[model samples]
Target: MDLTVKIKRYNPEKDDAPHWESYEVPADPLDSALALLLHVKWHIDGTLSLRKSCAHGICGSDAMQINGENKLACSVLVKDLVDDSGETVTFAPLPSAPVIKDLVIDQSRFFEKYRSVKPWLINDTPEPERERPQSPEEHEIIEDATKCIMCGACTHACPSTWADPDYLGPAAMLKAYRYTFDTRDDGTEERLDIVDSPDGLWKCYTIFNCNQACPKEIDITRWLSALKRRAVTSSASTAA
Candidate 1:
């Protein structure tokens, strides 16, 4: 099948603003969008820039806004995008972030918000003689949230993040939930303090855009709601 890929390009030193560039590719319908991008970079235009650590969708580095939705290029197939309407697929850097070059957006701010949630285990009581163990049931509670690859798709798709960049977006809140709900974690109170702030959890209006953009099929809005309830419940018990 023949596919036309439209990319939004930006060169900080050259163009004052981003612009559109298109490429015509003869490709298999089974080809991934990332595969198409690689084809363009390799054969069509060497200057075309994108980030892809693992084209299998593990790194989530190639996350971009495709057809007006944030998605991992590797997870999106050409056949799905190529309908009778047109065999054209539009690509842009993740929204609400500075464009670096072509399809790459500056993810520094995205990671900053992610780190603020303390995504790692926070048990500071003491080092156990053996690794702290968890049952399948306990791990399953947070299993979905743990699937996050920090793609920033959820955060970029979020209206709250767009309205106010300072707002702690869904990705971070999901990180908060990942550990806060983990029975092995001991920093629930500390993490909740950060998550309960005005610009943090409250900023999310439960729009569910994050849910749709997530490539992992994670129920992000649902997990965020669970975090909200957790904060309220934690605060109430403290008051009592």
Candidate 2:
């Protein structure tokens, strides 16, 4: 199959503003959007630039707006996304982030939000003397949230993040909920504190864009709902 990819390009040094550039390329059933990007860089246009670490979608480097939705370019098959009109792929950097160049955004701000929630396992005890035991029931509580690859798709798709870039966004909130709900974690109180702020959980409007953009199928809204419930219940308990 043949494809026509229209990429929105921006270069502070050259162009006065962002513009679109189209390229025609070959496609196949096994072809990924990332593959088309590489083809563009190699054969169509060498100046086109994008980030991709693991072409298998583990690194989350190639997240971009494909046909209006934030998705991992490495994970989406061109054939699946193409309309009946055939191969016309639209590409752009993740929305709401400063575009560093074509198909690349300054991810520092995104990472900062991720760090604000302290995305890590925090337990009080030292290394387990023997083995840390957790039943499937306990582990299952946070299993969905743990699937996050930090792709920034959820963050990019969020309207709150678009309006207020400082908002921690759904990705970070989900990450916070991951540890907050973990049975082995001892930092639920602190994690809740991190998300209880104005820019944290309170900012989410429950639009569910994060849940829609998640490639891992993580129920971000569900986790966030649970967190909100815990917050309300905890406050009530403390008042009692």
Off by over 4 Å in 1: none
Predictions in order: lDDT = 0.91, 0.88
- Lowest summed lDDT across 10 adjacent residues in model 2 is found at 78-87
Clashes of each: 0, 0
1-240 in candidate 2: lDDT tens per residue? 888889999988898888999998888867888999999999978999899998997888899999889999999987777854366889999998998898889999988988888778788688987977889999899888888999999999999999999999998889888888888778877888889898888888899999999888889988999988887887788789
- lDDT (10s digit) by residue, model 1, range 1-240: 888889998888899999999999889988898898899999999998899998887888989998888999999988888764388888899998988898888888888888898988998788889989999999999999999998889999999999999898999999999999999999999999999997899988999999999999999999999999999999999999
Tell me each candidate's RMSD, in Å, in order.
Answer: 1.0, 1.4
Locate the minimum summed-lDDT window of 10 residues in model 1: 78-87
Winning candidate number (TM-score): 1
Tell me the deviation in Å of residue 207 in model 2: 0.9
Clashes of 2: 0
Pairs of residues clashing in candidate 2? none
